[model samples]
Target: MKSRSASKITLTSYDDLLGGVATLEDVREVAIDELHSFTDHPFKVKDDEEMKELVESVKAQGILTALLVRPLKKGGYEIISGHRRKHAAELAGLKQVPVIVREMDKDSAVQAMVDSNLQRENILPSEKAFAYRMKMEAVKHQGVSGANSAKKVGKENKDSARQVYRYIRLTYLMNTLLKAVDENIIKLQIGVELSYLSIIEQEMVEEVHDSTGKYPSLEQAKQLRKHREEKSLTKEVIRLLIIGEPKKKTSITFKQDDIKKYFPPDYDEQKMRSIICQLLEEWSNQNH
Candidate 1:
């Protein structure tokens, strides 16, 4: 890392630092204020265990990858992706972290953040949903403002307004489910399916959070959802199920004496049983 001098850093070319960036090995540390974290990235589910492991690896391997950033209008640079990596670096006592400095406008900055994190092979479903929604919102902000507010590519901004509209639909989910979606436990398609239920049904889904400790299996969620569709369930009922009950399950049983009441007085003991068995065997053979 170079000195804590802004004069040394400049947005020269995106590709030159595309895979390579200046490492601040000489600079032991940079003040946290010089870096601005991106407000747009969506993966916020913190796994403390995983973070601890990340800190350990960073301690051993050093920061193998450089964080992405763009110069802010004010002074510092805003992170695009690699917030977690930055954080882990900090926890590992990194004084200076490698970064790619680029020039981009508001919409492009937001879009770049989403696209960078999302193109990974094992992208989580909830992460996709949230990223899609975030990108849609960013576009909406751009459209509402003006063309100048968005960063220009070669052509006029051509992203479909309707496509952006579809992604924004995800925000309608109740908070519990949205968090579940963010954590990647719930599928985005399943979230869309759940969204079709009434507000009361949505509340019922929310109520179930305490009982399940996680989202229900797709089949179980389907059953609750089916009942909601038939209008046989109300908000109160959904709430009750979601809240759950403490009742114990009981087993069915019958004594031998109680079973005798159904027998006829004319019924034979051994011979009748043998004849019935023969008949049942014949019926089974015929059906096969």
Candidate 2:
């Protein structure tokens, strides 16, 4: 998908131009001296070979796309998106890459960066957690601010504001699992469930996780969680089984006719059958 540009918005100072236009010449390559990885927007460069190929391609084509950046009050610009592009530019021996400058408060900057990354087909679970957390915090700030106003934002925006509350809750996770999540070693929704486990519990969960290699469904994780809570299983014990499939609580279903046909004519027994009452009657009786 084509990235949307905020180039139309012009500003007088570099800070005000945080979300505005930036040209290649206007962007500087200050010796890679003071630049740091974006704290809020973290992602790993997946393929070194691919990145090298990208650098070669970029050198040949001259950075076909520009990176999105926000102004830092101290110095240089915060890269909101196109991290790979920046790395490729460095490898390509480019002095300065094209960029779109924009004014984004901390929260807005994080959300913009995350939103852009989420659009990608694949992103690390750790990356998702941080990005999701950033967006949620931004929405939360917006909600708190809107609450004080007489003309407050409507319910939809308010709901939108709360949409990521649970996702953001994942940020409280310990570094090990957080790294696992970021590495795409664990599923996002599963990571959310794992997040509910306390720090100690999460460590145990991680043990099972590491032993399992690949996580089972969330249902299995929930069962492991329950088993730990109820039976007080040792972490090692849970690790032994947690990676495997969960047990089926109910038997598989088969058509009654199919079962009956397989049996002899006189094999009917009351013990073999169970019944359910009609829901319509139950509803009518409840109303009456």
Task: Give the TM-score of each candidate.
Answer: 0.55, 0.58
Whole-structure CA lDDT of model 1: 0.61
Candidate 2: where is the Cα deviation over 4 Å?
A: 1-36, 144-187, 208-217, 227-288
Write candidate 1's Cα lDDT for 38-141 as tens digits: 77456663658888998998898766555668878788878886677788888899767767666777776877787666545555545655666666556657
Query: Tens digits of per-residue lDDT for model 2 on 172-267?
Result: 778887776666676666667667667887777776666556554677667666766686656764565565456669866768787677456766
Which residue pairs does candidate 1 place in steric collision?
1-23, 1-24, 1-25, 29-95, 207-242, 208-242
Regions of model 1 farther than 4 Å from truth: 1-30, 45-49, 139-169, 180-187, 197-201, 208-233, 236-288
Clashes (N, CA, C under 3 Å) per candidate: 6, 10
